[model samples]
Target: MSTTFWIIIAGAIATYLTRIGGHLVISRFDNIHPRVEAGLNAVPAAVLTTLVAPELLNAGPAEWAALVVTAVVSLRGGLMAMFLAGAAVLILARQFVG
Candidate 1:
């Protein structure tokens, strides 16, 4: 909409180009450093731990209730039921609190 918007668009383009260029440059390798490979291998577990660790560490009573509902819904009917159960919890909480 303005000069700053254009600059942001250019920045995004530059960032995308750098990402593609980096992958093209690095993926050409026949062999890579073992440490680099090991770091890459740990990335998935690291991301999952970071995402779940906060919830696990700081969960309160309400969170425990939600977690129990989510687990049961997920086990019985997968993600859809879990989402519905979460919405139900929020609505029920609002009914009592508000």
Candidate 2:
């Protein structure tokens, strides 16, 4: 009921409408060009690598050590290994730090 609430509601509505509008417009284009499709496919991977690279490389000693353990487990055990290793690291970190 306040001005801030109305502003937030308006912003949410605008965001939703913009996304829906993009989908509608792009849907009318019969087929994506091959280059554009390839770019789209690579976008998420590029973004994720950019996001994860710093965390994986630039952390403190324990964090780096955890990542090493994670990498070993991840390589040997697949996705499950990654999750278990991450959980172990998180628990250990909490115990030591917080």
Candidate 3:
């Protein structure tokens, strides 16, 4: 009914179509070249960096510190650990340091 609702619906449909189209195209490929595989593997990280880097640059010290800690912990931990550690550090730093 509302403009925001319609926008959300359109976004969901677009996302679904994009994913299905990618799957359909990839499934037809009998053999993927090494370069193409490398490019495909890089896509997620590239997209993530594009989404995160700008916000990170504008963040405060607490957020920066949390991100640094998360990055370090990511070497030894899973995604859940990184997320929890970052959130906890940010909360604590905001409460005590800020």
Candidate 4:
């Protein structure tokens, strides 16, 4: 196998190990502290920010329009709705802007 293939396999294995390891450790505790739970709940938002912040630096008008639509939809809808709204706006805006 190529080096790239091995690297992908290694990364997948590492990710799986970390996920399972966390589950195992948490399951050992009967009750989770509120602070720990709050931190866990915040992980998704933090991850999303990390992913989106870099993209903003190079975003075009189409991307900005999609982001605004996504944020608006997220305030009133679920994850699926937010994703679909953003995608629809991105496609439509790109057609005209690009």
- Measured by lDDT, the strongest candidate is 4
**How many residue pairs clash in each candidate at the backbone level?**
0, 0, 0, 0
lDDT of 4 by residue, 1-98 (tens): 99999999999999999889878898899999999999999998999899999999999999999999999998999999999999999999999998
lDDT for each residue of candidate 1 in 1-98, tens digit (9 for 90 to 100)? 99999999999999898779858877799888999989978988899778866886776555656667777788778778897896687567656654
- Poorly placed runs, candidate 3 (over 4 Å): none
C-alpha TM-score for every candidate: 0.45, 0.55, 0.80, 0.75
Give the Cα-based TM-score of candidate 2 against the true structure.
0.55
lDDT of each prediction vs. the true structure? Answer: 0.78, 0.80, 0.92, 0.95
* Residue range 1-98, candidate 3, lDDT tens digits: 99999999999999999889878887798888999999989999999989889997689989998999999999999999999999999999999768
lDDT of 2 by residue, 1-98 (tens): 99999999999999899789868877899998999999978987899788878886557756766767787787779878787887788678857765
- Give lDDT: candidate 2, residue 65: 62
Best by TM-score: 3
Runs of candidate 2 with Cα error greater than 4 angstroms are 1-22, 69-81, 93-98
RMSD value for candidate 2: 4.5
TM-score of candidate 3 versus the correct structure, residues matched by position: 0.80
* Sort order, lDDT high to low: 4, 3, 2, 1
